[model samples]
Target: MFALGCLALIVLPLLGFIAGLVMGGQGAGLWGAGIGLIAALLMSATAALALVKAGRKR
Candidate 1:
């Protein structure tokens, strides 16, 4: 889960940029940026939730 979060935070934007390059449109870059931002938020949220759950389990 933590790894996934990191991937979301880092890998997503990289992927998005590459995708934009491939697609070649004004909106593509924006869309990629949007997706990347969303992914990063999700990643952080998921990581925080996981941490809480882990603490509770302990």
Candidate 2:
């Protein structure tokens, strides 16, 4: 589960960045990429915290 979350943390934002590039231009794409990266980092951090909490409970 944690591994999958980590994979999602990489893949999801990459997809978003590519989509942004295709749909928009350089500026929009850059902005989208930045947003995607930030979102991914936040998501990954949250997932990591959750996993750690669960492990501690166990």
Candidate 3:
């Protein structure tokens, strides 16, 4: 999950922008950017959660 999250943080925005531009135009690209940002945030949060949950025992 951590690896997936890390990869997604980079891929989501790039793919979103390209896909939006291809599908529509600048306006759609903006929308894609917003959506990608939100998705990235969620994925990163998951990565953080994983780190906390994987901590060494006391």
Candidate 4:
């Protein structure tokens, strides 16, 4: 469940960014893609931290 949530967090933004690039043209698409990538990275980091904390607790 946790993994699925994290995966969704990472993938949804990426898909949206790709869609934006296809429909919105270069400038807006680049901005959206940058934001999406940053968001995905942040979510991935948060998930990794949570996993580490969980492991330490056990």
Candidate 5:
């Protein structure tokens, strides 16, 4: 469920943007690129936080 949620939030939106770009143009590309950047940043932060918590457990 968690994995699915992450994929939906982080992957699908980016895919949408790419598809839009292919079908549309620069504006769609820019929008998708922006979303991809934000999703990547958020996923990176989440991974970092999880690593910290795991490290503290040891």
Candidate 6:
């Protein structure tokens, strides 16, 4: 899970940017940024939930 989160945080945005550039449009950059942001938020939420759940066991 940690590795997945790390991957999403790093690779997701890089892939998005490359894809956007390949596609080529006025809003291509925006699309990549949006994708990156959404991925980041999702990963963060997952991580937070995991932490909370783990803490409750104590």
RMSD of each: 2.1, 1.9, 1.9, 3.1, 4.5, 2.1
lDDT, each prediction: 0.80, 0.78, 0.84, 0.73, 0.71, 0.79
lDDT of 6 by residue, 1-58 (tens): 7677877887777777778877986379668867986887699789878978998995
Q: How far off is model 3, as Cα RMSD?
A: 1.9
Please give the range of 10 consecutive residues that has the lowest summed lDDT in model 4: 1-10
lDDT of 3 by residue, 6-50 (tens): 888888987888888889998888788778878988999988887
True-vs-predicted CA distance for residue 41, candidate 3, Å: 1.5
Give TM-scores for every candidate, taking all chains together and pairing residue i with residue i: 0.67, 0.70, 0.75, 0.63, 0.62, 0.67
Deviation in angstroms for 32 in model 4?
0.4
Candidate 5 global Cα RMSD: 4.5
Q: Which candidate gets the maximum lDDT versus the true structure?
A: 3
Q: Which ranges of candidate 3 are over 4 A from the true structure?
A: 1-3, 56-58
**Residue-level lDDT tens digits of model 5 in 1-58:** 3354466566756785787699788798778767776776677668767867888994
The prediction achieving the highest TM-score against the true structure is 3
Superposition TM-score, candidate 4 onto the true structure = 0.63
lDDT (Cα, tens digit) per residue for candidate 1, span 1-58: 7777877878787778678767977578768867887888888898989899889984
lDDT tens per residue, model 4, 1-58? 3575577676767776787788897766777777777777777777788888989984
Clashes (N, CA, C under 3 Å) per candidate? 0, 0, 0, 0, 0, 0
Tens digit of per-residue lDDT, candidate 2, span 1-58: 5676678778877777787888897776777778877877887788889988988984
C-alpha lDDT of residue 28 in model 3: 89
